[model samples]
Target chain A: MPLNISQPKRKNAISLTPLIDVVFILLLFFMLTSSFVPWRIVDTPLSVATDAPAAPEERVNVILTLKQNNGQVWVNDEVLSLSDSSVFQTLVSDNGDAVFIIQAEDGVTLQSLMSLADRLKLNGAETVSIANAFAMPEAK
Target chain B: MKIAAKYAARKANDDDNMVPLINVVFLMLVFFMVAGQIRKADPIPVIPPQSINDTRAATDPNIEIVVGADNILYVDDVLFTVEDVQAYLEQAFSSAVNPDAFWVQIKADGDIPLDSLRPIFNQVRLAGLTKVSLATQLEREAK
Candidate 1:
């Protein structure tokens, strides 16, 4: 019997199929699990009942009332359009250290109140507090 | 012989074609992994109000309260009433490592009425957690 030795052939050490499979899985995971919304925070310091009351003499207080029916805002007694930034800017600047008490009446959307609070804080109001007008009384 | 040669060529070409696809897929994977934030979805969909304030919200807070436009409340994805939230907050506060530093993040729908949202704040107050952040989106335009 004559020895017939076949020439050695090159063999693929690793398959690309598995590697591609993993990459595809990762791509799918990221595509399905990620969120791209740009979220920001507006510091709304809650007036906890536990805090000691500040001195009334030193800090000025400004009342920002949001009316439900008209979608208007009132800085104390004077009503101003929420979009009018100039007047509110002046109000914020005049009372630099004032604590703005935002009172949103019934039916006022949370968005309007948040926008006004954001404006006040942006204009350099030191302390902005929301008055809990709709706070449900103690329900045990 | 010609047919075998053509089949071999086709096989090589098929592998080469996959390289570009793999490269593009890798790029997309990296882009999504880096650019996107992985967060649990909110219990209810909420389109928050927009603001020019550039403060970024904490990625994860100790307490997250979600208020829907329909006056529904969700605490940690569980439906909660005003009274129930107060109890939940108090319990959360006690177990917190630093109770005073634990702030609550409120994600409320822009269309939610203040009447529906205020009681939650009052509940948070009763819990003794003073610090609160209202989640808002960055205003897109000059307005």
Candidate 2:
């Protein structure tokens, strides 16, 4: 019997292993680079006191107390909402030297505090400080 | 005979294919390790407040304070006490690698009322570390 011989046909095929490996690398690159919650810094005024030349007319200090009265915010003793542009203008308009002291009551949201801060800053209340008034007494 | 011979050749090449796959994966893993910021996990759960003025992406910091919604304080693994935390911060600041460029960040929960947050602010101030920043979730990019 004659030995049978046949030509072996090679099938054309594209391997997906490299493509999958590349995709995995890309996925990991994004996972590592991306931050979950974009963190931003809101600069709070420093409590450091600076000595100034006491002028003939000293700047009148304004106290805009933030107290939650019946679940509402009272800004500068006025039941003020952030929407009222008049209240922001009035609080910051009177004098150039007016330094607004924000005395926020415990349980008042920072959301409101920040909004009030923005308004105070926008209306030109040069320096705004969060009061450490309610701070606990120093330990013996 | 030819078909059997061809099958044997292809099997020989497939034997060492895993070596190249491992090499590519190793390179990618190293790339991620170098490029990412690996922050210490917050001790207590903190959901930072949202802000309309949040613009800048927070960069590297010298100190970080996490304020939970329930007003519990956590300085890394240590349970923060009023005096201890202050003293720790004071020490950290004084012995800091770069005091002039030192910065601190407070990661406080949005639900934490301002009143509840008073002591933390006071402690930061009393530590003689002025110009501390309150952390906020970046709302959007500026136009």
Which candidate ranks first by lDDT, i.e. highest? 1
Which residues of candidate 2, in runs, are more than 4 Å off? A1-14, A18-22, A25-29, A45-57, A69-72, A94-97, A122-127, A131-140, B1-41, B54-59, B76-78, B141-143
DockQ of candidate 2 against the true complex: 0.33
Q: What's the lDDT for residue A19 in model 2? A: 64
Docking class of 1: medium
User: Every model's DockQ, to 2 decimals?
Assistant: 0.61, 0.33
**Lowest-sum lDDT 10-residue window in model 1 chain B:** B51-60
lDDT of 1 by residue, A16-128 (tens): 89999999999999998898878888777765454577556566777778887365787768888767788778988888888788877778887787677777776677787
lDDT of 1 by residue, B1-143 (tens): 89987897798788889899989999999999999989898998889987776788555678999988788889999998878998999999899997657888999888878777777887888777778888888887645
lDDT of 2 by residue, B86-106 (tens): 788888999988888777777
Fnat of candidates, each listed: 0.89, 0.57
User: Cα deviation in Å at residue B130, candidate 2?
Assistant: 1.7
- Worst 10 contiguous positions by lDDT, candidate 1 chain A: A130-139
Give the number of the best model, judged by DockQ.
Answer: 1
**Every candidate's lDDT:** 0.79, 0.68
TM-score of chain A of each: 0.68, 0.61
